[model samples]
Target: MLDAVVVGAGPNGLTAAVELARRGHSVAVFEARDTIGGGARTEELTLPGFRHDPCSAVHPLGAGSPAFKAMPLERHGLEWLHPELPMAHPFPDGTAAVLARSVAETAASLGPRDAATYRRLVAPFQDRWDELVGDFMALPSTALPRDPVTLARFGRLALPPATWLMRRFRDDRARALFAGLVAHVIAPLGGVGTSGVGLVFALAAHAGGWPMPRGGSQAIADALAGLLREHGGTVHTGYEVKRLDDLPPARAYVFDTSPSAVARIAGLGGFYAGYRYGAAAFKIDYALDGPVPWTAKEARTAGTVQVGSSSREIAAALDAVSRYDRAPDVPFLITAQPSLVDPGRAPAGKHVFWAYGHVPHGWTGDLTDAVERQLERFAPGFRDLVLARATAGPPELAARNANYVGGDIACGAAAGLQLLLRPRLTRSPYTTPHPAVFLCSSATPPGPGVHGMSGHNAAKEVWRHLRARP
Candidate 1:
């Protein structure tokens, strides 16, 4: 028996456990896989000595996140590495768009019209970013500060479609590049609320400069696990907590698993007639001999690349995924080549690339060659550099991480109805109707990416809840 049991060792679960242990509570974490760091773990997937981050590799959100910043994983043997530049968006015609740390430099690279618009749109938040971000990141139902200016700005930024924002850009390259970045939210680019997703990630890129954890994202998770150990916390890996009754007795339990897992663990107790499902999903990883040769040289600067040609192109791809159809020709892709920045990731001159494209939920399309073909369309000879590849369709993805149920990475849909009334409209997003049982995974607010804020936030609520009882 312990004060708490966290049922996952991902960044979020570790974050929740660490927060509890720091507050002097006994906490235990259980992970299904022998390895911790769900999604953040690094492994030699391709070949000997070639380390690839199986899930998320780049960290704009992780680096800029206040949650991770406070954790100070760097103190525990983790180093956050920033490339000379953040990301490069290259086009088919040999031109590239680069997002740099310096606003002036990024703009200068874009030239006058785009440079001014980019700066103008993003610069106002510089002095007020933290204040503004706090408001935007808050759950839509949460009462915000009574600042009219902040509210107005947040509404304007969040409510608009990403395509609307792109219309402001005069340069075609600039529009395509920014649209690609925003599509990381897994939403249609031209759809409403897409701007909010784009704004947060873009702001983080310039603010934190998009970093990679040295060695791999596992470094961050290892640091959290080490910290928990130092604090008398225990983690049991290779333990899949299928039933709440099976877990060791604890005053409280927080689930870092997916929404569907929560339902399963809760069982047929009148709590889950309203579960969500993903109709389409697929994941593909490639092991390239070198970097993705971009048609435009500047596109190589970015650690993450968005692969839709334009806003319309991005929207259609997303729509296809939503409709559970294999998008024709080019699919929307979120790519991260950490080896471009971290040479230790692969053998000398041999690079490891990681990418996952949107696919029909449960669709078994092997897009390894399709992904390469799209890359080749933008970067000639891209196919020649491929050394090996691996892929996980919906079933395989669900098999790999139960939290990624139906291969829905955000744990659930990130847009529309799900975002507003996530899992249910309880007072605390972490807790459900079930007592001492909590959902701390990415399924909660401020969803997705490698940031462990949801778990940290949920841990706080659960800690208070348990402390207030008995």
Candidate 2:
């Protein structure tokens, strides 16, 4: 009895509902879990009074999210808290490389030798960030971009292996910093298109200081849900839709669940079934008595700390995850110290730490000690600061959110052709063979992140198709 029915109340689902409702269409969203925000969910996973984001904690994409920017989330109570610095990568020699809001400051932190190259690398779109990001963040297009030359330049830099991209830099600090950014891509470092992933994050960090929600990432979910309700859309929590038959009659259906879930539910055999999931994540949330005693001063200030000694070491660890299917002895850590900016995340005189490392897909590996070991390597006495720790290996992460199939948090792989032609290489990636249904999760283009581009794009197509109806 609705114009559109969205299954899954994650960012994509909620965004689709809002988009449909905004265009004068009746919409409803159904969520399997009691709470929303698939990757963006937050909870007191550790001890009570210590709020930790179960999956996605930092928000480079969220802050620069075009879909989120279009909505009135600020009115619905969404605030982004930016640390003094966006990111830091500490080396073995008690030194650090930091990325800050200012490009010059960031380059200075990279060291004198690499400073100019760092500037040249990121400064192309620095002046035109607002103009460049919209096209970059949207799904790939055959159509001409607003800035063709800039896009071409970026593609040239982004299309290579991350190792090749960093190879230009002579200093280990600069290479390591860039490699750490690439590691967020959740693929092998030497993989083609890995450089693009790293460049995008680095550019985004400079453009929009990687921030977190004031309270927790849950605020992002709550704001989206709240906005959806304001537009006369309904959200039914604790309601799981196994198939199209389970849903109330609607003209169109958009699924924000994983490709595997859709394939099973819709009986789409080869296409969706063949969609590959990338590396998984083994996460640990800690309630700390004090801030991590980081040896490097930059690590003490930055919200994100990449705990890998150098690019070579990071590449080896990434290779281990992508090829060997085993947990690396010294895994790369992407850590968030939310308490630095948002003190309310924990109880008085306490702090919260969010961190995760890449793991082989569907491989169950214990990396708690490995994570702690790396933590201690960068921050001496890190073990002593922990009041309590909550860990989620591959199985636990996937169990908590179906979108994270095998704990691959980016939803689907962003490697090679998969980056653009996700789920399948159809002209209309969002729309299935069935015109009435569409795939609107991160499995689509513009890949993953907390941004709602997949849902936004899918809703536009669905609206266009439905509008053509008599």
Candidate 3:
């Protein structure tokens, strides 16, 4: 009998296992796949030497995670490489808006007209970026935030819809850039609480600058796994836990999976039927013959690039994601060019790029051509350099990881109600009716991101439950 049985070996599950093991509790992790690393996994998806992150590549959440900061991942073989620019949003014209590490520089890039507005909106929180992240990332608390006043100010701006937030900017450059950042929310741009998504990403770029693991996101997962083993946790890959009976006896079971999957795997019944899931994605990874020839100079140096023309267009496209079942024409695309900064990711002089656009939930349309068109719109002749490509639509994503149900990468939507009480409205979202069971996936609070807070947070509760037992 073990102290805990962690079902899944993703970043969340590994973090849970590590946390329990370090506290002198025996732990075991079971992964369905031959390999682990869930959304953080990297592989040769296209051609040999062209490594691609299957789901998540750029890590604003992972890099800015307080939980990851506490770990010795760096010593355990994790190196984060910072780009000159964290992100770039390109327009139809031969220009781009950049999110640099420095707020002044980022504002300046937007031009003097919108510079002050950008500074005013972002700079106020820039100096307190650490405090802001600590407050946002920590488990929900009734007590005031570390900096309540600062949080209140942030909340005023973040609580509004992203479309409303765009009103603050005078020019398309700044507005478009912000819209791109918020599009990660997977919610309609005009929907409530969308600005928070945009604000967090911008704050994160300034807090620590968006950095990717040296080799790939896999490095972060590998390091967490290594740390777990060092703490005496057992990891068994190629072993899927279907029913709770499949797992060894333990005081507690932490499930790093969707609320829907957990109910089936552990016989907990069903999640709230009213649980509203938002959009899914149509993703593509390419093995390029050469660097993407972007007309925008800033995009050449950016690690993650948001490919779209303007805020208005991005908002409309994203709106279709929530209201319709079909993918939008000229969709907003989020792209990451890893080989531009890390040579280990591709063959010499070659590059590996990944991009994805929002689609309706469980969308099965082949969006390969549509996504390629969007890419070529900004970086003309970009298709010429594509030696090979791999794509994952909704069905494909769901098949790979059960958590990414219907290709919804966020696991659960970040809407008005779901954002506050994810996976359902329970006093303890992680805790199930069964005392020994807990949901540690991104489905829990502090929502989506590679940040291990969900796992770390759940483990604290599990640890308490274990300590109470004889």
Candidate 4:
């Protein structure tokens, strides 16, 4: 029996396996797909020599993650490339809200009142970015920063609804940019615990500057996989463990999958009994040729672009998502043209644009036309840029990685009562009720993103248990 069997070679799984291997344990990772890197993958879909990131494109978490930082991805062919402007919020009127590498520049562009408010909001979190980041990324039970400064920093931003906070800012541009980042919470914009999503990302944009991998997100995943292999860990692809019996016997089994998959694979077995399953899934992916061709000049410079015109527009779109329905006509979309930052992504002048909008749980709608039409609203003649498009509806996404049940990329809901209690509020978030079984995927707390803290924390927990064993 191997010391550990990580089921899913995603960032979290690979991180767990690497830690276990480093700790002198025999570890093996089983991936459902032939290719590793669950969400952080690049493929040549639109055209030859055009590498597009399938799921997650721009990674703010990747730049700020403690686990990934400790891994030193820079040493392993991960070129951290930042845009002159971190992100841009282009208006229908052709103006833009650009988030520069410097927080002052981004805030100042918002006018005096917004500038002061923006600084005040993010200032407290600035000094403690590292701790706040860790607390946000770790599996809940990992201690929140004991330092008063950091604690205050966390509370100031996390303690309000995003809608409530947006009202405090005077300028529309600044509010929209912050709202765009917060919309990633995957919950209703004004909903509980949703505000923290805004602060976390806003702070990250200011601190680490939201760097992207030069080639693609796959580089980071590939580096993690290479590290796992270097540490004597084996990753088996095309092996889907439908049941516990299907997996190779190992002392510990860490699943990088959703709660539903966990219940099915392990037969509930008193392991995931208490958790409810009502996660909101989505169908998301975008394909485009050349640039977005936004009327706003700054949009061409931003790595991330927020499409929703107003904060209310985004809030309403999110409100639709909460009702388990698709947003009307123009949905809130987080679109990124990675080719802008990494020229290697496209051929000569041609580029690839990626975007995903909020949707209902288990939604089966083919959103290709809906999404394309929406993009055309912002970037005129966008259809002309579409060389090809790939639509991973909820079911297809769920089928690809059981972790993303019903195409909920988060593996579970990111907010609400379960935000901190996800996968439960135990001292060790990864350990399950079943003996030596663990949940290290985004399904666990600090839910979702390319941050490898979930896996890192899980490995540490299991290491302690293994060490204590006679």
Q: Which candidate number maximizes lDDT?
A: 3
Q: Rank the candidates by lDDT, best first.
A: 3, 2, 4, 1
Runs off by more than 4 Å, candidate 3: 142-144
CA displacement after TM-score superposition, residue 144 of candidate 3 (Å): 6.8
Q: Write the per-residue lDDT of candidate 1 for residues 1-470, one digit (tens) a residue.
A: 78999999999999999989988899999998999999788888778878888778888888766567777677788888888778776666676677778778777766677888988878877656666655554554244554558657766876787788888888777777777776675665655677777767767777878899989999989999998988999999888777989898889988888766776886736564565654334555667777878777666766777676665676677777775456445776777878878899888988888777777666666766677677777778877887877677777877877877667766777666565456766677788777888888887877787888788778778877887985
Model 2 scores a C-alpha lDDT of 0.86
> In model 2, how large is the Cα lDDT of residue 317?
89
Clashes of each: 8, 0, 0, 2
**lDDT (C-alpha, whole model) for all candidates:** 0.76, 0.86, 0.87, 0.77
For each candidate, give its TM-score against the true structure: 0.93, 0.97, 0.97, 0.94
Per-residue C-alpha lDDT of model 4 across residues 348-437, encoded as one tens digit per residue: 877777777777778777666777777777789888877776667678777766667667777776656665578765667677677678
Candidate 1 at 259: error in angstroms? Answer: 1.7
Reference-based lDDT, residue 422, model 2: 78
Stretches of candidate 2 off by over 4 Å are: 142-144
In model 3, state the lDDT of residue 171: 92
lDDT of 2 by residue, 1-470 (tens): 78999999888888888989988899999999998888888898889999999988898988887789999999999999999989989887898888888888889988889999889888887877765767776645523478878878888887888888887788899998888888887777777778888888887888898999999988998999898889899989898777788899989989998887877676666567678888889999999999999999889989999999988888888888888888888899999999899999999989999888888898786899989899888899999989999999889988999998888888887666786577777777888867788888988877788888788888888888788873
Candidate 3 — worst ten consecutive residues by lDDT sum? 135-144
